[model samples]
Target: MRYLPLTDSDRGDMLATIGVSDIDDLFVDVPAEARLSGPIEGLPTHASEMAVEKHMRRLSKKNLAAADAAFFCGAGAYRHHVPATVDHIIQRGEFLTAYTPYQPEIAQGTLQMLFEFQSQVAKLYGCAVANASMYDGSTACWEAVAMAGRVTKKKRVVLSGALHPHYAEVVKTMAKFTEDEIAGGLPSMQGSPDDAGLIERIDENTSCVVVQYPDILGRISDLTEIADAAHKKGALLIVVNTEPVALGAIKAPGEMGADIVVGEGQSIGVGLQFGGPYLGLFAVRDPKHVRQMPGRLCGETVDAEGKRGFVLTLSTREQHIRREKATSNICTNSGLCALAFSVHMTLLGEKGLRTLAAENHRLACLAADKLDAIPGVRVLNDAFFNEFTVVLERDARELVRDLAEDDILAGVSLGRLFPHEEALSGGLLVAVTETASEEDIDALCSAISENMA
Candidate 1:
């Protein structure tokens, strides 16, 4: 039976307090067409437990598991080799059920782990401070924009054309309520990203300039110039790194004059897991901006007995003591995912991470060369870390679907990302990692060649 938390009288009293005549009236802002008038058209609403289990098992078989295929579908989420130690460590009884470390005295272990996590992220991003974690990369990106707005008291946000379309959509969606002017358009397919064009869009009213490192098309650009342009216009430069592994080989965003550095921590310790539970890494290049940063910051301190201890240094969320003065309304963070990322990163250390990144790039280069050799196929980016885009003779969506039928998950199609944009129909984004073997690359290339031919 369904659980009803509120009685009719209780709901009526709340409705009266809010000046709403009824629950349906509360949904007045929602479009009439979007509201469901009746039950969905499908199979029966009731089913035996055993029958439902059988049906779910049947549906699960249709999914082509990433491990069972030559997977290369990293636009934002990546497929990486997570050490068994990471899983083993996070699944421990203590770490497994850990949530917010509200009572640091009793939650010392969790607090200390978070402290180390924040320190690792800050050093990795070349920033002064980092929060515990956030929901995911997209929400973290939006929070950075909101933080920038609070800092600069401006409402204009200029997005890089090559920024991930999903990230851009998240920013724009959140901007609708805030009424911030979003200035950007679809990324142009080219050898290099249009940094000059992005700079031109920034002005005095701009709050932040958002650019993705090794962007959606997998092209890498020096963000120094863009950062300088934003600073000159009194705007903060917010760098979004979808692939944190790239940082092991490339310059940290904070070092390139980014005021705020944010990214997905999935590449390090977290599995793609179809889609989330991914970790969002947020940090600030300058120490002054730490108070304005979202999520909680863990800090180390000395107790009354002169013993070492860790505590919640700063928590500006609505649930905390800040109340209305909170930096963000983000209630809880991805504690488990953050712990997983921390464990994976700790296992890799600095040198191991560099080696892992190098291998990914090596495999990616090999795959790009093999793909470029196929007639009517061209690698678009002049320089990239571990992922890049390619233009195909046929619609990439159709080609991708055809390859999937043969148990090969080729890559993500630009047409799928930008469905309404015809010009991007032939573009395909390919990602490579340590998990992809040389034989897998050959299989993907041969499949594409055969399909094109």
Candidate 2:
């Protein structure tokens, strides 16, 4: 009662006022399986603080630690070297303790950093402008589609098979409420890096075509033709990215005429943290659509004394009047995470990022070559940045499990993401980065070869 500070009578009155029979009504929108059953597993209703800490530590150890294992894990998130300076700066009490910059005068520091983050992100995507941030890569994908719908006044979105299925699912979850049509989810496995006929699927009803840059399987393409095709149909090109570092070496999506670009910025200053609290980057090539973009935007200006200052700008229309017409329901940016990303990108600079991108490409190529040497495996991508998929003779999930037993993560299985797709049964999505050493690649190659044999 002390912790809850709410009595049974209070809860009943609150529920009754809301016209609900019980608290269960609150979770009506959540899927049943996703809801808690009675209580969480192994966690007692009451436990000592020390006991709870110990239990959580032990449970955490059961996971395959990314640091200890031959970690090749990448479908969307990736492993990259983050400088110690990045962490130190983000933790400064002034930055870490601060909340969203509600007032421009007192929150100048945060606003300035966000302005820098938006600039770096826009440059990376080669877009005219970018928002302060979004939730993460996947949710950004949803916002991109919804923004496209707003901009074009259309109801259909055509997704490429190459887009990350997780991102597509996020878009689908939001689509449940709208009349929007989400077309194409089948993965383009083990074929030409280009979509077979994805561009041809675009039509008058289409608002945007969502395509992944260097795709989920780590396949790379020019995207010029797809952009041209989408433009011809009066639809915008929405490019989804999971990794921002690829921009260092590949052609920028904005340069390719992509109207909107969004992706995860975790590969920069942020660690995997097992999945979330990752940064979402959003950018648009057209200045006309800036008002439709989600989250916050920062701008630069001069003060009364003509000194430089920063301010929060370009909030979605929904932030003001017409609650139902809100351009974005995302309340605020991933401020801390965005700061981390900006710090990391600043440290990398242009030359350093290019060097890092090149190293990652080299390492991935080496990994792909080594994996292809295995008798039962074939590297799928003709060109890639850091991550790529391989077609294996055996079940990918089984192979990953067997290698896990040998202290190797091996790779993610395509079957897990596309359980019903018989075509993806033996596919493995392996990721390589600058962090992977020659020994790591060799160990994974040996483990996979021995496991297959």
- Residues 1-453 of candidate 1 have per-residue lDDT tens digits of 134689888999999999988788888888988977667888578667788899999998888889999889999999999999998988898888866777877889898899899999999998999999998999999999999999999999999988888999999999999899898789989989999899999999999999999888999988999999999999999999999999899999999999999999988888987788889999999999887888877889988899999988765445567777788888888888888888988988999889999999999999999999999999999999999999999999999999998878888999989887889999999999999999999999999999996
Off by over 4 Å in 1: 1-59, 316-318
TM-scores of all predicted structures: 0.88, 0.88
Best by lDDT: 1
RMSD, one per candidate, in order: 7.1, 6.8
The CA lDDT at 54 in model 1 is 98
lDDT of each: 0.91, 0.88
- lDDT for model 1 comes to 0.91
